[model samples]
Target: MNAPITACYPDPGTARPLTGLYLDHALPDRGRHGPFIYANYIASLDGRISVPADTGGQGVPESIANARDWRLFQELAGQADLLLSSGRYLRDLEAGTAQDSLPIGIDDAFSDIRAWRVRHGLAPQPDVAVLSAGLDFAVPRRLLDQGRRVIVITGESVPDSRVQAHERAGTEVIVLPNVARPGGAALVTALQALAYRRIYTVAGPFVLHTLLSANLLDSLFLTTVHRLIGGQPFASLCEGDLLAETGDFQLASMHLDAHGPGGCTQTFSRYDRTPGP
Candidate 1:
């Protein structure tokens, strides 16, 4: 049981091509509100997005991170106007624990995406917006060398000195008037004002939970690898206590690839937010 992906849910016919599956989506046009926000995640059958790594940091289990999923992941990143991330990622980079770079379309594997960005009149790499209330990480020098516009978003309680530090590095720092946590509406309003129409969040689950809680997420792309990973100290796609009202998403598309690591299979699905004001 090993073959390329085939469309299943809405329509079924020829084996759909794997590449450009996500890239074909007109993400920027669907933003009637602030921005069309989306996130990409690959999980195991048991819903494990990450497990304990040998280096003490959590990592995506290799068995669940097959190459096909990675291709779609890159495609998602390739279409973003800005990538929503966290300051903790910079801390991890300094600690030599970070997994991947913040920039997309740089490596030869996806160099074509950079060209595609140019063709579509977008920058080589999407700008990066780091969400943090602590404001305690140094922007890596290599990121600047790659020419990514790094914007820092922090709460009002943060010290002015911290904001200036990032500004001094030519990194624009946005200090929102949020104390406990920047709820979904405030954050999206700020992003929308900047004219960022396509927001792709690659940050951890906390950010996704924040967006979903506010019903601000527009799309969710998930790849479920047909494998079970059960272990202590693992993480899932969304985390936190049960929400007052769980978010609802209607499936937009689904595809099945009969090949995964060790003869397993994978299901790639996309869900759109139910229409609401």
Candidate 2:
């Protein structure tokens, strides 16, 4: 995939093909409420999604990482079924200082996005949850040997012996009742009561500012790596109290992926969360 691309919002230059461009888009229920929630990132141009990495922590700032924005971040994690992540990315994946969780179907340059998730049935690698309210971390046995389904979501003040040590290591902890922290409509109504239609956070920016300060994100998919590096304890995209009024959004599409790094230019936006103001 050499990234043949174009487009400039709604539709302009046309000629697209960033590998199936985020797989059609499966959202409805008004905002895909049943589970069409979405999120994706890769910033810079002053937004700095991360920086200061010498392995002590923080990453993704190699002057706006490249490879055509990781092939649209593995085609948006190959159209997720469930991949919202956090808890400091499982403590930086046991402190090896992890990065690149956008690993789907084990990448052979995304094997045609894992055969488009087996011709659209999905689930050859998506099920991951995680979000942590400090239950601490450690769930990376290569994501349970790729069978997936490691879940863990958190809240309700944790510590029932850390939720029975992640349900005795079978891991499936979800605890968000009465809140102690777990917003964004209680984490998509608890993954829409565990049915998880198409939710996909792949966590960062404090869970995209808790689903855009709780209007419950419909779609985002940013990329913007036009280049810029100011360095100063960075990490952006959203990380606390400010966006409200449903954090309005609107650009339903846009692109420019002239490939990044030295080649520069990599816009790739996709907004869509503005039903009101």
Candidate 3:
């Protein structure tokens, strides 16, 4: 209900709250993890993250809504440490598109990532780590060419042949146990081992759900657009018993776009508001 938030994001019938919500009971304090991990996403009013045909470009059915969505989207991307994602999102999003491919014969394209890392006192290029059962050769190649580290976390059953080739190419291919929990654990542990303390997981419902259910999400950033984007299938997390347990969550800081469109960007934040038993 902040003035600036409504003014910057004044779309009616929308849930564009200035400050969103954060729900976590694992950590006893705000900065519990050596470095906190932020899980971010954008959902429709009806809780959909995708369109019916999977052709809505990037989930927004309305132009204005898309603009607002991208504003927050870019902001989060600009501030994240390691952009962690799963192989499925890469394939579905065609993340292998050569549009930003290495910027061959040019040093210009690498500047952004380089500068961001330096500004944050991190490596020149943040690692673009993928959680996969095997190497995503096509995507990793492009990321590597852009000065980004291509790390593939796989399982024991991953084909031996591909693993060998990827390692030879200087890609960090980690093979973990064949269990589901171990996969994520291996990923977090490996990133930590490689000095990647702050990680950002941006992906589809399944990946997000896993982190949330595992109580690994330290923070969540979301952009709630103002529209009815029905038809898209979504994995709803706001249901019945889920609602009661989620109330322990709290809001930290609120940032209403001081100067911008009448649409506000809320940072629904909550630290360790309640003491853990």
Candidate 4:
């Protein structure tokens, strides 16, 4: 395990600010394959996603680090018209409970993320989509209450009662026969069909691994705090060497903070997956 690197982010007092740069950084030129989607994340120098102590959860950071992370999160969260995540992330980050519903204040907090999008003339409330092996009624009900459209993707057949519950609360429940793995492409198709562009996928390693392995990622944003921690590399985006093939790849431009509390924001050069050789 690598040790945590000591880093610092802007103190929110900088006058020039990052808003415009962020807006420009997020919206890439569109392509026929689809609108550009960016994957946003933060990690320790060693590439760990969560805290290592198993303090019954991912690692914890000091207030400054936490603030910087949330700042990055809010910025990216504001840019996305649709926020997608695996059921596991929701469970770990939001619920931490087996029941389907989120806590009462959850909707309002999400509303703030939504408001940022609206200020930029993006969607008022992004369609919050979750993929799971089974139904979790808590999510749809909680998210819908916040005026966000909640979408539940499940592999198992959804019971009518759950469907009715979602509809009553103004959420959408989608059922798919095959959702065990590699379901992200299908989920993207489904969301596109529902008119959701500018999708953002955030989650733990497994879902991240699935999408990368499927070659579905278009952009990757990382906040590299100059710290070392213990964790594994995220799964590679492809099965084999893809850079050497013809018509196979493109450049990804990245912007790093000229200074930091040892923290830097890195955005991946966006591109489509080239066909396999």
Candidate 5:
């Protein structure tokens, strides 16, 4: 069942009209230039992104069981021109163990969003861009074989054979120079070249850490679940070496849905990067 959004903050004042799934306000315009990157994630109250010690550490399943969170996830997917993900994240979705709906599922739930995209001269579906350093992973065949544009961004460390395999599967490959951190200027330039302006990333902790550290993320959408799963070595929402200094974010909007089926209260918040002094 689709859950109704209980409340939205900073109510869309009378000035800007609300539309479709974007009930609070219209999506921000993506100008002719390229990429505005945002990310969406769900985490537990205790800040764990994954189940205790689970090797594959994809956090969606562990945190996003509530209907409200699921609906918000779909809404965010519908607004993006491109969806960025890590190779392992894509593989988890393909295996059906991610315990979350696919990006394509958004097409069915919110056809109006798709229609809006087409009217604005955008593709019927958002492009999926997967990042992998080694390029040694398998994604759902449907993602490649299906007529959707799938681009693989990898480091030169990946062998030519792997690159050819991805090409054979109908994916475009861009080989960037290997770096200590992958989400830097090169990745942004590549996305700009493709003319992808609004990019949404749904990924695990390591990927988020890289983007956050690089100061490439513009906004963050986070859902905090009521339940807590405590155990050793659980992954948090940002799982990498600690940043040299803290990153600051200002809350842009917040919503609360407390009437969940299992007495769960889910809070969805959008935070924009706080400017440096």
Candidate 6:
């Protein structure tokens, strides 16, 4: 069952009640020439994104037992024009026990959001874009088939054999200039070239850290579950050394789900990047 939203603050400054918020109407406006990047992540109450030594801890049975979170996840995926993810996350999905296709929704649902996309002259399904330094991981064969569009972004150092393999599989492989690392700027440029204006990223900590460091992240939609996972060396939502300058995010909206099963509480918060002074 879909959890009822107890409270919604659409505008933090005004704090007015927002009623009847649906996924189709809640999506952000796309830019004309560039991408508006937003990320969605779920964390534990103790601020852990993953369990110790296990990167796929977020998929544990105890972590994602909430129906409300799953509903929101599907809604976000259904509304995005493009789904950006790191190569590691893609590989993890392949190796892990998760579902093969994108988790758009359960029971083949989200018809309303799909219809909205079509009415707006957009594809019903979002394209998947994977970012990696080198095309070393195994790209999903199903994703390479027709009817599905997949974009692979990597540096020039990727082997010619790998590039050919992806191309032969009908994947659009983009090779950027070789650098110490593939920064978010390069990824944004590639996204712009493809005319993808609304991008939703479901990335791990490392990718989030890089995007945040590059000032490429526009907003973050975080769900904090009421659980304390503090046994092992878990990673946070943003993992890396402290930045010389910190990024500031202003809370744009917040929603509360108080009637979660098992006395659990989930708080959904949206933070937009604050413009530089």
Worst 10 residues of 2 by lDDT: 23-32
Q: List, residue by residue over 122-213, the lDDT tens digit for candidate 2.
A: 87888888778877876877777778888888889877998887778778898888878777678768877888677778788887887776
Clashes of each: 0, 0, 12, 17, 0, 0
Off by over 4 Å in 4: 1-19, 29-32, 52-55, 59-66, 93-116, 140-142, 157-170, 179-185, 231-251, 258-277
What is the full ranking by TM-score, best candidate first? 1, 6, 5, 3, 4, 2
lDDT of 5: 0.68
Candidate 3's clash total is 12
Better of 3 and 4 by lDDT: 4
lDDT of 3 by residue, 133-247 (tens): 6455545455667677777777776778978887887777778765443234654455556565656666556565555444556766655544454663444432223422342
Of the candidates shown, which would achieve the greatest lDDT relative to the real structure? 1
Report the candidate with higher lDDT, 4 versus 5: 5
Using Cα atoms with residue i matched to residue i, what is each candidate's TM-score against the true structure? 0.93, 0.34, 0.66, 0.66, 0.83, 0.85
- Least well predicted 10-residue stretch by lDDT in candidate 1: 24-33
Q: Scored by CA lDDT, what does every candidate get? A: 0.81, 0.77, 0.49, 0.51, 0.68, 0.69
Model 3 segments more than 4 A misplaced: 1-31, 53-65, 93-117, 134-137, 178-188, 235-248, 254-277
Candidate whose TM-score is highest: 1
Is 2 or 3 the stronger prediction by lDDT? 2
Better of 5 and 6 by lDDT: 6
Tens-digit lDDT string for candidate 4 (1-277)? 0112221323232333333334435465342336555666565555555543333444333311444444456666667667776666565545453222322113454454555566667755466777666455355345666677677776545566766675676666787556653355575566457665676766555555555544556666665555665443333222234423232344333334433444443321233444441
Tens digit of per-residue lDDT, candidate 6, span 1-277: 4435644676333322222233636565564226778888778888876663344434433553466666667767766778887777676767864433664543645566566667766676788888887777776776655355888888777788988987886788888775535665676576678887678887778778877777777888888887776746667888888964687899877877764547777777888888762
lDDT of 6: 0.69
Better of 1 and 3 by lDDT: 1
lDDT of 3: 0.49
**lDDT for each residue of candidate 1 in 1-277, tens digit (9 for 90 to 100):** 1246888777965587787788765566456477788998999999999888788878778778887888888889888878998877778877888878777856687876777788778888888888888788888888777788888887777888988888988788877765546556677678777788688999877778877877778889999999998966768888877876687889999998887788898899999888776
